[model samples]
Target: MSDPAGRLNIQLRRTPHGFACDIGSTRPVAASGLFCGRSPAETASLLPLLYSICAKAQASACVGALERACGMDSDPEARRLRQVQVAAETVREHLWRILLDWPVLSGEEPDRQAMIGAQSLVKRIFGAADPNGVLLSPGCEKPTSFRSVLEEAASTLADLMAERVLGLAPDAWMERVETIDAFDDWCRSVETPAARLLVGLRDSGDGRLGHTEASPLPDLDDGTLAAELRGTDAATFVARPCWGGAPRETTPLTRHADSALVSALVADQGRGILARLGAQILETVSLLRAIRTGELDGDSTAPSDAVLPAGVGLGRAEAARGLLVHLAEVDRGRVVEYRILAPTEWNFHPDGVLASALATLPDAEETILRRRVQLLVMAIDPCVAFDLVIP
Candidate 1:
C-alpha cells in the first residue's frame, strides 16, 4: 500500500558505472481500494475528494468507468465539455511550470502575478464552458452556450503565453523551432524565463543530461488493459507497471513524441532534458489552440470505456501528465472491486523512466549532481514531491 500523501525517496549510491538509483514511493497506490463496497454513484462522488491533484482527470476516469460498467451509452456533449476542462487544466499545469518553476531554475523570481491572472482566466473560461459541473455525473448533460466566452479566453491565454512565456506567438514559435539548430537559436535569442532556462542548460553543457532509452508507452485497447488490471497480482502491477516486461514512459514527451519540434529535438538530444522540456511547451501550444477550436490535435479518441463482462468495465482519460485509467467491477449497482492505474505509477516506478535517467548521471560534485537530478525530475513533472538522497 503506497502512502496517499507520501513522496518519492530517491537514493543514489555511487556505482562503477556512475550511480545506482533506487526510487521508492510512499504514495497510496491502493487508494482505489476505498471504492470497494460503495455504490457506483457513491464511488463517483468520492473520487474528487480522494484525489485532489488532477481532480478533473480523476473524476473523468471514475465517471467513465462506472458508466461503462452500468452499460450506459456515451454522452457526446458531456464528453466534449470534459475535454474542454481537461484541455484548460493542461494549459494551466504547463503554464504553472513555465511561469513559476522555470524562472527559479534560471535564478530568477517566479512571476506570481502572472500565475494568478492565468488561473483566473482558466476558471472564467473553462468554468463558463461547463457551468453545470456535470463531469462527475454519468450520462448527465446540461449544455450552456458559452462559445464567445471560451473563444475570448482562449485568445487571451494565447496572447498571455506569447507575451510572458514564449516571447512570440505560439504559431510563430512552432513554425520557427522545427530543427535542433533553430531551437538553440531561439533559446539564445529569446528574452523569456523559459528560454533563459534552456540557454542556461546549454551554456553549462548540461543540455543532454539524463538522456535515456525508455520508449514511450504505446496505445493499448481497453480490453488488454482491463485484463492486466484483473490479474492476480493487480496490486503489484499497478504499483510498478511494465508492458511486455519493460517499463515505459507516459509523460508529455511521450504524448508529443511525433510533433515536428519534439521529434527533431529527441532525434538530436536522445530524449534528454531539453527534449522533455520542449514537449511540454509544444503541448501547451496545441492545447491552447484546442481550447479555441474545440478540437485537440491527434486526440481523436474520446474517453474510452470497455465492459469486459457483465458489470465490469475499464475507463481511460488522456490527462495533463499522461493517461489516467480506472477499472470497476460492480455487482447489484455496488462496487465489488475498483482499481486505478495513474500515470504516476508508470513514470515514477522504481525502475521506470525517472530511474533510468537518474542512473545515467556521472559522478560529480554533490551540488551539480543534485541540480541535474532536480532538472530531470521537473522535466518529467511528477505528481508528488521527491526527496533526493546522494550518498
Candidate 2:
C-alpha cells in the first residue's frame, strides 16, 4: 500500500504587497525505482500496493505500459473493467473532497450520512467489477455479469447527487448548469451542501480570490516523455513536472475542459476557486453517467509505434485528479527502469497552479489569509496532508 503519511508542507511568507507561497511535498517518487529488475507481471502486481489513492488508475497504466513493452495488446474486456474501476475511484474521490472537505470553508461539519452513502455506493460498484478483490492486473479478465450491479449503483449515485449535492435531479442540474446565470441562481437559492458551501465562499470573497491565468493543457507524447525519463532522476521528475518547458495545471478543470458546465464556470469565474470546484462536481456527474451507460472506457492503445521503442513503453490514464503516466523499460524480460508522473507533481509545483493562485491574493489579516489558503488548497485537493505556515 502507498505511504498514507505522505504530506505537503506549505510556507506562506507575507511579502510587502502580497503573500508568497512555497510548497514542500513529500510524495513517494523513489518507490518507482524498486520496480527495477522485476518481471512485467511482478511490476503489474505491485502497482496497486504502491499507489493507494488511485490504485485502479495506477494499475491500468502500469499494465498498459508493461503490455506494450512486451508487444502485447490489452484485452478489450480487461480494458473496460479497468475503466469502470477508474470511474468508481474518481466518483469516490470527488465526493470525498466536496462533501468532507468543502464544508470546512463554511464552518460546518461534513454531512456524515452523505459521506457514508457515497463510500458505500462506490465500494459496491468497485466490488461488482472486481469480485475477486484482486487489484487489476494485465490481462485480468472480468465477467460481463456486473451490469445490473453497476446500474443499481448509478441509480443510488443519482439520488445522492440530487438530494445531497445539487438539490435537483441529475437531469435538472444538467440543464441548469449550462449557463453562469442559472448556476449563480442555484448557488444562491439551493440548500444542498455543495451549493451552500459555494455561496459561503462567494459571501466571503473567496470565490474570486486566488485567481490566476490558467495553465495550458499538457500535450506530451510518448517520445517526449521517454526522453525526459532518460534525462532526469525520479525525484526530479516527480517534484517538478513541466510540459512544453513550463509548469501547467492538470486538475479536473483541465481534464474536462470541453464540458459545457466547466466552460461556463471558467468564463464567469476564471480558473479561480469556484471554477475549480464546479469542474470537480461536473466531472463527478459525467463519470457517473459514463458508468451507468458502460461508456467509461478510455483509449487502451499504446502510443504510436514510432514512439514505442522495443524495450521501452509508456501508458497514460485520466485519473480522478488528472492525467497519470507510467513508463517502464525492460531488457530480457526484466524491468530496467520505471517512472510515475502523478498529477499532484504538476499541480503543486512551486511555479504551478496552487502557488500561482496563492501569490495573487491581496493583503488580508493573517488568520483570514490562512483560511483562504486552506480553502484554495482543498479546492485543488492534493493527495497528501499539508501544513500551512505564515511567518
Candidate 3:
C-alpha cells in the first residue's frame, strides 16, 4: 500500500549553486513538471567532459566508482602502485617545456611536442626508484655517500633521456636495471624532482641550495614554488606530513554564473608569442603527481542539495596541467542559476592592473612569480584542454 511513484520522484534543477539534484523528496513538489532530465549517456559524459585532459584520472574515477557500484572488484589499492608508476611517466610526458633543455635549446624552452622527452628523462633515471622497485646503484657490498651516488645516477641517465628526445635509442641508459639488487641493499629511499636532480649533478660537493638532498623532505627542491615551500605544506610533497593543523578555514567557493564573468577572463586573440611554457609544464606534472601521491583535495562543484548543503565540495581532479576546481552551486540548475569558474579566473583576476605600468619594478627580481602563479593555476586543475596562460 505504498505509492511506487514516490520512488521515481527525483528532481534536478539549475539552482544558483551547481547542477541541483533533488532526489528522494518527502514532500510532493510535482516532479513531472519540474524534473531535470538527462540521458544516461549525458550523465556518463559529465564525468569525463569535465576532466578529459587527465583522461587517465577521469577514467580512474569513473571506472573505480562504477566498479564499486556494480560490486565488481578492481582492487584499486593493488593497482595503486602501478598507477603511480604510470603517473610518473605521464606527468613528465605532459610538460609543455623542458626547463633543463632550455640551455640546449638555445636558452629557450622546448615546444610541447618534446614533452615525452622530459618525462622519459625522469623515468630513465628513476624507473627503479619506486619504494618496492629497483634502481641501478651497482657494486655496493656496503654503500655510503648517497649524494655522490645520486649525482652519478642522475647525470648519467639524464644524458640518455636527452638522447631519446632526439629520436635515439636509450639502450645505454636502459640497461641500469641490472643493478637493482645493490641499490636496494641501501636503506629505504624516497623520490622527488629535487632529490632526483641532486642524483643527476656531477660531483658538485655540498650541493646547491635548491638541491633536494639537503632538505628534510625530498620533493621540495625544484620548480617555481620550492622557495615558498621551504617551511610549508606547499613546499612538501604529499608523501610528507602536512603541518599547521588542518588547512585553516578554507572558504568553499560559490557558483556565481554570469557568462560575462567567465567570458571576460578568457583570453581572446590567442595571447600569442608567450615564452613561459614552464607554467604549462608544472600543470602537467602536478596532475601526474596526484595519481602517484593522492587526490589533491580541495573545494569541488556541488549538486546543490537544498537541505544543509556541504559548504566545501571538492571539484578537485588533476588535469593535464594541474588541479582544476569549480567551487559553486546550481541552485535551481540552469545557466542563470549556476556559476562557472575556471583556474585562469583566479590567476588572471584583475587585482588592479598597475601591472602594465612597470617596465620592471626598480628592484624587480623574478621573485618566484612564475612558480607562484603556476601553482595557483595548477591548484584549480581544470580539465579543459585549452592553454590557460595569458603572458
Candidate 4:
C-alpha cells in the first residue's frame, strides 16, 4: 500500500570535526492495518506480494509467527525448506550488489548479462527448494526429492560467483585469498569489479573511511523480542530499535564477523567500508557452500518464532540485509495485530552504526564525499531506496 517498503532519506552536513548525519525513513513500524483481519493462511499468501524485496524472508517470518499464534505444529523439514529459500535469496541479493552496483562504483559498466544469469539461477534454486510454493504456509508438506535440486543449485551458484564476482572458486578464495596479505593480492589480481572496488578504496586511501566502533547485534531470544513487541512502548521501540540501551548493527559485516576473511579485513581496517565489502563477499561464499552441503544451520543472530501467551507469537528470519521480525496476534482464527521490525530501522538509527560511521568520514570534495557516503550506505544495504543529501 504505502510503497511496499518506504524510502530512506539521508542528509549530511560538513562539520569542523567530520560530518553530521540525519537518517529518516517513511517505513511504518506497524504494518498491521493491511493484514489485521486476514486469516493466517491469507496473511501468508499476501505478504510476499506486499514485499518485493526479501519476499521469501518476509513470508517465512509471517507464516512462522502466524503458525505459532494459531497453535499449528510445523513439519521440521519446513524450517529447512525456508532456510534454503532464504539462503538462495541472500546469495541473489549479494550477487545483485556485486555484479551490478560494484561495477558502477568502480567506474565500469554493470555486468547485466551475469546478473541475468544469476537471477535465473536463483529462481531455479528457489523453485527446486519450493516446488509447491507452499513452504510458507502452515502445515504445508515438504517437497520430496528437492535435495537434487539444491545440489544443482549449489553448484550453479558457486560457478556464477566464481566467474562474475570472485574470479576464483569459493573454496580457493576462502582458503588462499582470505588472509590479510592474500586478500590484498586478490584485490590487486582479480579482474572482477568487486575486486576493483575494494582495490580502488584501498589505493585511494578511503579504505579506512567510515570506520565505526558500533557493536554487532547480539543474538536475541524470541521471548525477549516478543516481550518488547508486546510492550506499551512497542511502536517507538520498533521504529528505532535499540538493545541494552544502545543501537547495534545487523548487516553482512555483523552476520559474518567471525569469518576469517572478514576478521582479517576488520583487523586491517576496523569496521569500515573495506571490511564491510569483504564481509559481503565472505557471506556470499559461505551461503553458497551451505547450499551445496545441504546444511543451512542458519546464520541469524535472532532465533525463530516462539509463542508467548495464547494467540501471540514472534517470528524472525535472517534476511539478505539483516534480521526481519514479525509479531502477530491471532484471535478467533483471524489476525488482530501485526507489527514488523525491519533491519533498516536498527542499522540506520539516528545514533546507530551508519550514523556513527558517517561521523568518522574525512572532509573531502563534494563529489568524493558523496561517493564515500554511497559506499557506507550500500554497505548497510537498506531495503528502501535512499535519497542522499550533502550540504
Candidate 5:
C-alpha cells in the first residue's frame, strides 16, 4: 500500500422517531484508506453523494466485523433492530423507486416533500438520540418529537404511492421522471437504500446469532469467509525485498497497518497474521467511526476480498449499497493493471460471478437484454438503473 488513510471506521446511531433508520457506509464517502490519496476530511465530504439515504449499511458492516470478531450473533432486540433496519432500507428504496417511476407512470408531479421526508426519517431511524438522553439523544430532549418524524415519513410514502396511482406528481411541486418497468422487476429492484444493516441484523451467517438448524444460513468462519470472498486464488504472495518500502499498491487497510509500522510488520518479517489481524482490528475501528458519523449502517457488509491480483486482481467491498470491487495486476512489483469490478458490475455481469468464471468470457450484448439486465443488476441489490432500451 502506498499511503493509507491513517485511521477510519463507521459508527451507528438510533434517532428517536419511534423506529426511523438509515443504513450506509463508505460509498463515495471518505475514499479513505487506500483507494485514493484524498484526505479523510476530503473523502468525508463526498459521502453524501454515495448514500444520502440510510448509511446503516456501512455501520452494519462494521458491526458485522465486530460480531465476527467477538462471535456474537444477536439478541432479541438486536435481531429486531436488524429486521427493522431492513424494513427501513426497503422503505427508503421504495421511497425513491416510487418517485423515480412516477414520470413514466404518468406525466406526474414529484413529491419532493415525501422524498425529503424519507431523508429525515433516515436520520431518525439510523441515528441515535443525543447521548445523555438528557437531551443529546432522541427521546431525552428535543425541539422536535419522534412522532413528527414518523408521521412525516408515512405521509411522504402515502403521497408518493398516491402520485403513482393517480399518475400525478405531488406539489405545489416540481416534475419528476417515472421509470416504467414490469411489476415483478420493480418489486425486487426497489428496496431500502442502505441494506447491509438489515443483512447483518438478519441471519446473514456471521456465526453469531441464530446459526440454528432452522436458520437459513450456514456457519462461516470470518477468517475463512473473508478469504473465500477474495477467491481461493487471491492469496498469491509477492516477496518485497525492500521490506519497509511501500507496497507498489496496497489496500487502505494495509496502508493503515504500514503507517503504524509497529503494527504492520514484525522486525523479523514473520508477523504475518499478527500484522493482518492488527489491520483487521483497525478496520473495525474505522467502521465504527463511519457508523457514528452516519457514514454507514447495519445494512452494509465489510468487503473482505479484493481481486487486485498478481496478473490482475479484483477487490470486492460490500459497501452500504452493495459490493464495490477493485481489480489490479502488479508486474514485478510495478503496477501492470488496475480496474474496478464494482458491486454493480458483479451483479450486472451476464452470468453471476461464479458462473462468469465458469463460462470463460461474458456476452455483454446478451446480458444487455432488458429482463436479463434487470436480474443481473438486482442480484447485488444495485442502486443504479439498467436502462436497457433497444436502440
Candidate 6:
C-alpha cells in the first residue's frame, strides 16, 4: 500500500494563561486534480487506491459523482452493497482507534491480536461482497452466499464491539446512553481494555481537556458547494474550506448533531474529549445495528441521467470521520476538473476545531501538556500521520 501523502505538524507555545498552538499540515492538498481528464469509470477505479484510508467511502463518492455527471441512476443492489462495505470499513476504523490508539493514552500495550482480528473481519466482508476487489464497479454479481457472509461478518464485529469496546452487549450498552452517569461509571470500572483507556483519560483530566466552542453543523447544499468550487479559486477552496468565511467542523458529532445520545452528551459535557469519544462509540453501535438488519441504505445528491449539466457535478458521503465531498466537471465523457474536500481539512483548519481545542489547553509541564494534546488530536482522528512539536 502507498504511504499516506502527507503529515500534520503541530507546534505549541506556552502563553501566560495557557498554551497557543500553530497547526500546519504538509499533507498533499488537492491531489484529486490528478483525476482530471480520466473517464468517470477510470476515476472511480483509481480513487480507492489514492485514498486508501477511507477507500470505500472515496470510491462511493467518486462513483456517486460520476453517476451524477452522466445522469445515471444508481443500481439499487450496487448501492446496498456499497453501504455494507462502507459500514464494515467504518467499524474496522473505529475498532483500530479503540484497540490501538486508545491504549497509548492509557499507557497500555495495544491488543495487537484484537486489531488483527478486526482487520480480518473487514477483509472477509470485502472478499465476500466484491471477490474481484473492484471497489467501484457497480452491479458486480455477488456469490449466492453473499448475504450469509455479511451476516457472519456483522456477528463477528458485534462480538468484538461488545467484548473489547463496550464491555456490554451492543444493545445493552446503547441503552445506557439514557443515563450518562451509569455509562461513565461503566467506562471507569469495566475490566475491558477499552474501558481501561477511558478510565485513564478521566484520571488524567481529559474529561475537561481540549474544551472549546463546537463549530456549527455543516449545511452546505449542492448548489452552494458547486458555486464555491466553480467560483472560488480551485486552489483556495481545496487548501482552506470555510463556510460563511469561518472554519466549521464536520465530525461524527456534527454529522449526527441531533442524535439523541450525541445531543445528550453535548448538553451534559459540551464538545470536549468525552463528548467526541461518546459520539464515535454511539455511531459505531448504530452502524453495527444497521449493518446486521440490512438497513444500510441512502441516496446521494448525484444526478441520475445521461444528459447532465456541463457544469460541476457534486457528490457527498459521510465518511468514517465526517462528510467527504467530491466535485467533478465532465465534458464529452471525460473529466475536465476534480476536487475533494476531506474532513481533515475542515477539522484541522488553522483556525478550526483542532486549533480551538489546542488553545484551551491549561498551562502545565511541557511533557504533560503534549500528552494531553496528543490525546485530543487522536480524538479528532485525522486520516494522516501527525507530530507534536513543543518549543
Per model, how many backbone clashes are there? 6, 0, 37, 0, 91, 3
Q: Quote the lDDT for 172 in model 2.
A: 73
Number of the top candidate by lDDT? 4
Off by over 4 Å in 6: 1-4, 132-135, 138-145, 300-308
Candidate 5 residue runs with Cα over 4 Å from true position: 1-54, 70-79, 105-110, 128-224, 230-346, 353-381, 385-391
Model 4 reaches what TM-score against the true structure? Answer: 0.95
Candidate 2 lDDT (Cα, 0 to 1): 0.80
Question: Lowest summed-lDDT stretch of 10 residues in model 3?
Answer: 208-217
Candidate 1 residues 309-349, lDDT tens each?
Answer: 78877777778789989999989879999999989889988
Models ranked on TM-score: 4, 1, 2, 6, 5, 3
Model 2 Cα lDDT, one tens digit per residue, 1-391: 5445388889988877777888887777668888999999998887788787888788878887887777776666666777788888888898988888877667878877898998899888888887775536655554454779878987798789888888887767776778788888988877866898888766766787778886865677788777777674655866687776788888888886778877887777778888888888888888888888887665543455556667888887888878888888989989998988888888888888899999988777888888888878988888778888888
Return the TM-score for candidate 5, rounded to 2 decimals.
0.35
lDDT of 3 by residue, 1-391 (tens): 6532222122223334322222221222222112123321232345445433343444333332222222233442323432443344345533332334332323233443434445454554234333333111111112122333323444443443333231222232123211223112210132323223223321221111111010111111112222222224421222122213211111001111122221121121111111012223223333333532344332121112222222211122233332232212222222111111222222221210111111111221234333322222222222222222222
Compute each candidate's TM-score over C-alphas.
0.95, 0.94, 0.30, 0.95, 0.35, 0.92
lDDT per residue for candidate 4 within 150-169, as digits (tens), equals 78877987988898788899
TM-score, model 1 to reference: 0.95
Q: What is the C-alpha lDDT of each candidate?
A: 0.83, 0.80, 0.27, 0.84, 0.30, 0.77
What TM-score does prediction 2 earn?
A: 0.94
Total colliding residue pairs, candidate 2: 0
Cα misplacement distance, residue 49 of candidate 5 (Å): 9.2
Models sorted by lDDT, best on top: 4, 1, 2, 6, 5, 3
